[model samples]
Structure formats: structure tokens, C-alpha cells
Target: MSYKRVIRFIVFIALCVQAKQMVAQNANTRPNIIYIMSDDHAYQAISAYGYGLNHTPNIDKLAEQGVLFNRAFVTNSICGPSRAVMLTGKHSHVNGFKDNHSTFDGSQQTVAKLLHNNGYTTAVIGKWHLISDPQGFDYWNVVPGQGEYYNPDFIENGVKKRVPGYITNITTDFAINWLDSRDKSKPFFLMYQQKAPHRNWMPEEKYYHLFDSTQFPVPANYFDDYQTRTKAAHEQAMEVARDMHDAYDLKLAFDLPKDQQKGLAGNWQGIYNRLTPEEKKKWEAAYGPSIEAFKKANLSGKELAIWKYQRYMRDYLRCVQSVDDNVGRLMEYLKANGLDKNTIIIYTSDQGFYLGEHGWFDKRFMYEESFRTPLIVKWPGVTNKKIASNSMVQNLDFAETILDMAGLPIPADMQGKSFVPVLKGKKKGDVHEALYYHFYENQEHKVAKHIGVRTDRYKLIYFYENNEWEMYDLKKDKSEMKNVYNDPSYSKVKSMMQKKLMELKKQYNDPVPVVTPQI
Candidate 1:
């Protein structure tokens, strides 16, 4: 061969050797990741977050073992959209999940896809409510709709099947089942998302009597008037009282019609179906009077509020109990298989919720309750155990963090910076000097669609749709009860936040108006 041809062959051999070594390096570095998320599970609901209202021992144990993020937030504090953020590692604007109405564009580049390309086994199990066919999942079994209390329908492997089991139990069962069968050769990434403690809070039969006698405390801001809020605060039909129908699932009306002359049989539906015409008429008359009499004898004042609290909290806590118990089950499974040490376990919710805080039940407001999410990370040989980080972290940061953890390049398209630095105890003070929030397309349980920004201690929200602005010095008004934006003392603070907001908009290519609308 000629000298030039000999040189070309040597270069080709060198390239082949380099390619094989790179593949081997990628193979050795992948980590097993288990991500568990619950619906409407607030940071305050977790005992680790220091809320005494609920008991969450297993979840608390996670905080004891891993680093707990003091301040982690979602760009949008809703279900489907937040999940999209986690999957795509991008904002709603980029992911096309601007709201629940928009479906997930899974064909686009995703974290799952990236991980899968880098040789990680990926599976998503539980409530996949993107409202479209899921993508980037090797195996997926998810609840359809809000699912059910008794028999739930789960769409699995492209087939919808009715599983004769409790919703929370079944979702966890599927999650464990996936984990048990995961490929051990390559490290895995499993998304265990649950439909717990969401709307119409219902628990399994075993957990039905869990909180039978407990008097769950009412949220601090449960009786808030809409004096300083938007039309949404006054119009949303999700209030604890004054909004529920008598026949609603909660059934707190306490008026069951007793058979006047006879008694209800075991087969009430059959008995009623076979009732004689005259017997039916008598039953109706008796039932109407019985229900009315109970209604007329109203339970109001403190008595009524306590009843509402009991109903709301009992159901809520029961759902949480199921979720916590299932977490224990997953942990036990990991220990048994010897995967606990090498695996990184994360538990959190789609977004923080208002558990009767400020007289509200739903989220989506720029308030701390909705904006702040519960993020607990237990990374193998990475996170500082038992360290509680009070830095402000956004869910958007997860995209960067997850990719960086796996030693993959975080795409420039993802605006969220990596907090993996903070988790590893490399940085101090605030992670993000400021966090931006924008909520658009305002419908669901009726939370106002507004855009806002949160700094270390102060929050400023601009109600663009309503042309109103609210500013809060979070250190003083943690409950966010007072708006001091109009005060002369905060004019300087407001101006600075507004300028920061403008800088973020320009940086992110979002040009929101800074002009004040004429009232």
C-alpha cells in the first residue's frame, strides 16, 4: 500500500477504538432512577415540611435520608402540564402543554428518549393524564380519566382494561410490577405517577376508616373573602362548602330516608326495582320529607365548618395514607432486590396544593401554596443525606438536573438551569436569584390565570387578564393575606421586581406588557 493509504487505515483504526470506548463509558455511567409523583400533594401536607395536619412517616423518612429542596416550584401548577414539563424538560410554551387542553407532543425530543438513547430502560406507570397516546415509554399502564374508586380502567400496552381493585392500590401495584420486571443489565428510569388525593378525594375500602374519628384541622385561610382577589377567587365552584351538591360523592348531608314501615334490605336496588307502585309512592313521600327535615335542621356556624373539615380532610388524609403506604412498599421492594443503594429515589407531587389554606382547595394562583412543590431527592453517593436545602428551586430545573445527573448534555432549548450543583452541596444561599411564573388559559377548578415572579422573600404577581397587581413581602405575610403593592414603601421594591420580570421576559424571548391598563 502507498504511504498515504497506510496513514488513512491507521486513522480509521483509531476512530473505531475511540467509538468502542465511548460506548463502554456510557454503559458504565447510567443510574437507576425511580421518580414518584402524587397529584395535588402539597409540601405542607408532608410532615417533613413541618405541617402537623397530616402524618407522613414514610415520606418523612425520605427527607431524613436525602436532601429535601426547601423551595421547588412548577412553571404551571396543574396536573397534565406539569408532567409535560418533567417529560420534555421545557416550559409549556415549548412543550405545547400550555394548558391541559393541549396534549403532549411526545414525538419531540424528551428526557425519556434521551435516556433511552443513552441505554437506560425507561417505563412510565400510573396516572398519565396527558390526554393523548403516550410516547417515549417502553411499558406504560395508566389510569384513564380521573379513574375510579372501586374498579378502575387502566390503559396498558395500548389496551384499556378494567382492573378490579382500588385506584391508588392498583396504580402502585402496576408501578411495582414494572419495577420487578425491569431490565437489570442496563440501569433503569421508572416514572411512578399516582392519581392520589386529587379531585373527588376517595380512598380504598381498607383505608376508608383510617381517619374515622380524627378531626383534621381546617386550613388557615379557608374563610377568605374575595375582596383582594380576582373573579376566579369568587367564581370557582370548588369551595369546600356552598358549592357541593347534596348527592355529591362526599354525601355530608346526613339524611338517609329510613323505611317508615319496613327496613332497607341488603339488595336495596333490587328491592326498589321490584317495589309495588303504592309502595314506591310511600317511599318517595317518606324520603322527600326525611331529606327535607334534615336539611332544614341546618348545621351552621362552627358546627357546620367542623363537619366540612372532617369530610374534606378525612378523604384527603386517607388518600395520602394510601400513597405513603405504597411508598413503603416500593422501598421494601427496592431493599429486597438490593437496588436501593445504587438507585436514586425522588418523591414529590405535580404541584403544591392549598389544603384549606387561605380558604382555598385548588391551586394555579401565584400564591406559595400552589407555586411551591414538595421535592425530595435520594441520590446514591450524590445528595447530602439529611440536609435540608432552603434554596429556591423550580421544576424547570429538573430537566437540567436529570440530564446532568446522567452525564448527558442539557439541551440549550431547556431554559431551566441545573440545581444538581446545590444538591451536591456545592452552592449556598438562593439557587435562582429569582423565579418566574406565568399561568395562562385560566379554567379547570377555576384559578386565576396570572403571571408573576418570586424572589428570596418577596413575590409580585401581575394579573394581566384582570389588569391587577399583587405584591407580598413573604417574610412578613407568609399566608399572603395582605397585598402591599400599592403602598409607597414598596413602590421601589415593585419597580425592581418589574424590571427583573422584564429582564426575564427579554431573556426568555417572552415580551409581556409592562404598561398599566386604565381601570
Candidate 2:
């Protein structure tokens, strides 16, 4: 009980405090990052968003633990371009990958390259549709293009090899495998992406009957005649009733007589053609009854439209269910390995999709369903817990935010402003007053090239190819049923929006290209 004994106890306590401080410092200095993206995953379908079409428990868990942005949008609402925007932190025009037809320039600076140079190991798995070998990752294994649902071939490290399994589950497996093998000493960034609920929605065999007993009500605007819309809407070919094929899309005409198949048999045979005999047997066993019933029903007109919508919803939601299941798998892996504590996890989509809205099933428009995407961010120690932010953010902001979170310098050339402050519930004001969008793909869906601006209460779009303008008061017309560009009551608002749209284009350096309408 002397001075030496007391000094010894004090020294032990100080050593313990020093070790605790060093642990906190390491956790803050180099936190790992995991960004999970789903193709054509709409905000409306997630149960957390309250649209009530289907449940996504894993995605909802991400929202429950972190910040969910209610107004997250995309710069361009297409597959390849949306990813390009996120990688480059610039609009599609600035990145030079404006549409699916174009190849991304690999030599350009990407966020991955930046992170890789700044002391972070980077990997991108699944659904890399950029049409170029991934340039800036320590490792990459991606699907070719709009990858198949069953037994898909993956381009792993530039070698094409067929992987045997459902696409979503296989993707998750590879992502976790990479995580297991990564260098533990260095922080890592992984883009675990998925291809599901995309066109010709194909669910895994296990979820074949998941939504069979559930009846989904048709969207009120599902029968929209495109009365108030412009030529862009009426001339498009994405109608669920007309464009969704029985053979390929709905998987119904496989049993019908080839002569009675309405000539769609040739176009859609590939989806079924890819399945092995055993896989095909399982798939048919699950869907055969519905196909037989549909053939016997003799549906036509509104009855046929409703029937097609329900089939579309069932298959789409089933695919989503598989995605949700895989998400849970990844979450469990992270938790089990003790990586959940210091890793910043993000869940989003390349862009939103139309779930039978406006009689359409594809995404290219500037409408709310396609333009607005789901964004959930979970930063273990930084983000506000279980909060939803109304601040308008975009896919463009993702790269800058990642760099910011990693304690790295955001390159000045990257155009996207980091919304990390918004995620932390700080600096709410000064978020952009309007978000700009531009879509350039014309030959695919017949939707004309367009540019527009969206604010909280209103949206203004210009169909440049058609030389038409459409405006909507979003507060009143969330469905975008009525375009009020020419309405006298909205003239003042239209003028202001028009000016703002042009200003945004200038601000983003997206000049409208001169069009010549192929002779």
C-alpha cells in the first residue's frame, strides 16, 4: 500500500486508455465501403417506401439502420448511363456514355481509380454493363449485358466463363467470396451489384410461386391512353399489354401452338433456350399451371390488359424477393465477420423502373417512377440513425460522397456535390433547388431524346426530338397524368422552369445536341 503500488495501478489505467484511443482512430481513419446496387429496382416496390407493391425486408433493414433519401434521383434513367454517371460523378453527357449503345472510355478517371490510388483496395462484382473491361478495380467479375437470370456467363477478370446458379444468388456469393479474400490490413471498396426485376423479369425457381396467391391492383394510370402526353409517350413501344410477349416476357406461350403464338415465339425463345433440361423442368413445373390457365381463359381487351399486368407484377416481385433474400445473406456475412461495425454500406439502383405505370414497363422517361430511385446509406458512426431525408440527391453525387467518406480529396473535375452532410442531418439548406435529367437513347424504346428539370413540387420536361414541352405540378399530379405546359394557369411557372432548365443545362455543361432525324 505504498507510492510504488499506486503508481503501478495508474500506469495500467493509462495504457488501457491509450489502446482504446488507437482503436477509435483506426476506425475513423480508413472505414471500409460496400455499395450494393440493383438494376431497375424501383423505390415504389420497396416496402419501406410504403408503395405496398411488395416487401423488401433486407432493404428496409438498411433504411431502419441508416438514412433513406425520399427524393433520390438519377442524372439519366437508363442502365449503362446511370452507372457511368455514378462512376464519373458527372452527367451522362459529360462522361460521354450517354446511352446503352455507347462504350465507356476506360482510360478516364473514375472514382475507383481515385480510391485505388488513395490507399484503398477496390472491387466491382456483378452487373457491370458499361461495355468495357472494368478499368480501376483490384478485381472484377461482371455479367455480359442485361445478364440472364439462370446459369449466366460472367466476364471474370476479362475471361468469359459460365457460372451455374440464379444470377442474384451467384452475385452475392462472389461478392462475399471477394470479401473473404481481401487484404485485411487495407480498407476496401466493393460494388456488389445485381441484375434483377429488369426486362423480361425472371425469378429464381425457389420463388416461382411466391406471389401467386397475392393479387396486385393495377395502377390507376395503367390504362392511360396517352391523351395529354406528347408524341414521345404515344409513339413509344414499352406498353405492358402490347410489348410484353407471352413467350419471352410472361413465359405463357411456351405451351401454346407455335402457329397460335402470334409470331412472338421467335423473339422470346432465348430466355427459355438458356435453361438446362433440369432447370427448364423446374421452371415449367412452377409456371406451367399459370400458363395453362392463361391459355384457357381466352382473355381480351381490359381483361387481357389486367391479366398481363398481374403476370408482370408477379414475376417482377418474385425476382425482387430473391434480391431481398440475397441482400440478407450479404448482411449476415458482414455481421458474422465483424465487418458491419466499421464499414459504410449503401443500397441503391442504377435507376428506377416502371411497375405498370402509364401502361409501360421500361425506364427512359423523366417521370417520377423512372427518374426517382431508392437510396439508403448506413454509415455506422457518422450517419443519423433511422432517419429519412427529404433533400433531393442524385446518382451523380455518389462518387464524390464516397471519396468524402473515405477521408480522401474529391477531385475538382467531379461535378457531383457530396451529400454526406445531408446524410449526417447537417446543412439542409443549399441543396440544389432543382435536379436536371437528360436521356439520349432513341432507337431502343422509341422515346425521343429529352432534357428536363425537377423540383420538389413541379417538373418540366422538353422532348427535344419531338419539339414538344410537358410540365407537371408534381404535388397535384404525382402520376404525371396531365401535362400542363400550355395551360394558361401555369404559364408563369412554366417560364420560370424553362429558364431554370436552361440554366441547369449550362451549369452541368450539357448542351443540347443538334438533331437531323435520320432521313
* Most TM-score-accurate candidate: 2
Which residue ranges in model 2 land beyond 4 Å of their true spot?
1-28, 255-267, 513-519
lDDT of 1 by residue, 1-519 (tens): 999999999999999999877765554456688889999998887898887878898888888889898888988888888888888877777788878788777789888888888778888888888888777778888877655555667899889987776677788788888877866557788889888888667565566567766877776678877676656567766666655434333433223355531322322333243344654565455345535654776888766655665677777888898889889888888899887877788898999987777666768887898899999998878864798998888888876788888888988888888888887888887778998887876765666677788899899888776677888999998888888878888888888888877776667665556565222
Error of 2 at 347 (Å): 0.6
Which residue runs of candidate 1 sit more than 4 Å off their true CA positions? Answer: 1-29, 230-232, 253-297, 511-519
**Clashes within 3 Å, all models in order:** 3, 0
Candidate 1, residue 134: the lDDT equals 76
